[model samples]
Target chain A: MDEETAKMIADKGAWLCLQPFLDDEDAIPFPEGTPQRTKQLAMVAGTENAYRLAKKHNIKTAFGTDVLFDAELAAKQGKQLAKLQRWYTPFEVLKMATFNNAQLLKFCGPRDPYPGELGVIKEGALADMILVDGNPLQNLDLIIDPTKNFVLIMKDGKIYKNTIQFK
Target chain B: MLFLYGLLGRAQETAEKNTILIINATVFDGQNEKMQEGMSILVEGNKIAKIAKTINIPQTAQVVNAQGKVLMPGLIDAHAHPMFAGISQQAGLTSQDGYLNLVAAKTAEKFLMQGFTSLREASGNSISLKCAIDQGLYLGPRIYPTGPMISQTSGHADYRPSTSIPYDPNATLSYIERSGHALIADGVPEIIKGVRSVLRMGATQVKLGAGGGVASIYDPLDVTQYTFEELKAAVDVAETWNTYVMVHAYTPKAIQTSLGPG
Candidate 1:
């Protein structure tokens, strides 16, 4: 259906199932070398190409994280890929996974001088928060490591995985 | 054999008489380094055939200088947004079709001048433009392009609200090509089929917007648009055809939602 129809469906409070890129007829083919390779190196590499698509389409995107399934899985594969490639930083990778995404989602609140109370450790408002052993504000991977930096409990939320502590 | 010799002789006569022995120039051979300074590099037939510390040069071999300039393999950006002479800035308003070919032509050249020997244009409906550059019809960098991005309605790529005025309804379709971007499909089957169509048209990589855009009117940016199964289905189809998917998202929810099981 055209965009108007889709919007109409959405306006009525219906969920719209979305598709991915590469599915567009307008997508340009990958260049000449390795033309035969099936794997999408650009996506896995998290190259600027993926970022450009996100920019142009105004869509939120990560290197290959969006296409990958699990957060931990994305981190694992992303790390492995970066390691084999030998030129990626884990911090940058984590940033792409967290804050960059937060920016796209407009989640962390406004751009004002620290909505200081927004993501702060307060009680009444968003009791739902994550408490990690190691500082995730510095390294994103720590958020995932149950051993390195275990997650406590969801203050006022449902927990999918059990909470654990290190020390 | 005679034809080959004749070709070589003709080449030898017209070619510059510079038998340059690049001694110890650092060469980044993609994988590793073979750094040996004293080795002499021979230049014959436009190719480096041998490297010896001491070698007898043909009387016609002209020795030149290579004091500096490390010979590391050229770097690759893998991605870029090239701009041209007049169309560098994409902010202002202009006739859409008027400069279509021109922008395509110049952007390709800009990519080359910037030393990006090969590049991947993330998204655009410019396949023919890419073909023109590929066939040497124009001067530009080698480009692998994804013609356009696929997004859902009122989704990250939906440009309706932004393009619309407080009083204009017809403005809807006007911005479809620009903001709604290209093929915005629904559900798993349609998504799969859409990807196949792009593949048929020469797409080397697939791109998708799995959540609301950074600037959406209805839902929050982090609001998930496609379910994990949906994205996985798209990825599966792409993989079957020898391609992969790239999703557009910013929020952790969007990222975590769109990408699954790695």
Candidate 2:
């Protein structure tokens, strides 16, 4: 997207949802030089530009891994977020994937089923949190493998996995 | 010193009656650059009641000593397709609905274990899966379902066998059409009906295919699909239902013409 278009998006209060996809993670297998393969590569190429434009234009951006129809590739969801570190700090990627993305879900408006605060860790916000085995901001790659790094997963104040050792 | 327990297993018993106190972790809080070190959080029922360095909780509360790990908001995928993300393109087109659902069900759990707490489904039929997760029959991320993507005939989502093209619109629904993966609609009336049909099936929003795409069998990357009236009709139906439309478009003509800067 051009700077003018990016500015229009911000002025209109629209969001640009982006995914960090590389060639290996293509949702479908596309052999080299095929029209589909070329198109797929071109789409991924636009991701970086859109992200940078959104930041430059102060547009609200959302993060997602649009890895579909490939369970093996889908497992690498966290890597998509971690790769964003190429364009942003770990903290920035973390925030965009969390609290910032939740803000966009609110656009569902009256159709929103899970009403109440989401995405933030604050008083009165929904208790959706994770306990990482290491500091994500310091080492974002730890997220690339959530099963090992996310020792605990809690949703709506309910603990689903708790493997932390006690003192 | 604080101690916690684990392995309540896959079935969530319900919101913990006892408050959960998580101590000794660095908190990200989802809105800051600087992480708060050595902090704690108290979850009462389903809300974070407090976050501090010291919290005096009742003896019965669940105390999780984080051991200085990172405590942050669960991840969210603003765009996802839980129902279609796992199976292969061929499997999605030919697999039985029942089998496909089971695969998607497993996919949902995998995504959750990956630390995604919420997902805004960009397309596909996940209404029943969302209901199942909500009822505690299974575990998965919160899904904001958008239902099947609507497309114009030979547009982005059209994946019918080549011989089947130009078939009578009045004929029995195609197997793929019956599968609810996508709908082939044309003109303003069909567009409105398509949008309303998905909404009837509990879609929170509607997705319209506004241009060509590579993954599908037909159309080049730059061809714009739906006309302005058909696209507007879809938007009108969604707006009347208090929702919105997300078009799958790739070019300026496809996007700007339909979804104006207004």
Identify the candidate with maximal lDDT: 2
At residue B88, what lDDT does model 1 achieve? Answer: 21
lDDT of 1 at A69: 13
TM-score of each: 0.48, 0.92
Q: Which candidate is the best by TM-score?
A: 2
For DockQ, the strongest prediction is 2
Residues A46-66 of candidate 2: C-alpha lDDT, one tens digit per residue: 667877887888888899887
Provide per-model DockQ scores: 0.02, 0.71
In candidate 2, stretches whose alpha carbon ends up further than 4 angstroms from where it belongs are A25-27, B1-18
**Ten-residue region with minimum lDDT total, candidate 2 chain B:** B1-10
| Candidate 2 chain A weakest ten by summed lDDT | A19-28
CAPRI quality level assigned to candidate 2 from its DockQ score? medium
- Candidate 2: lDDT of A135? 89
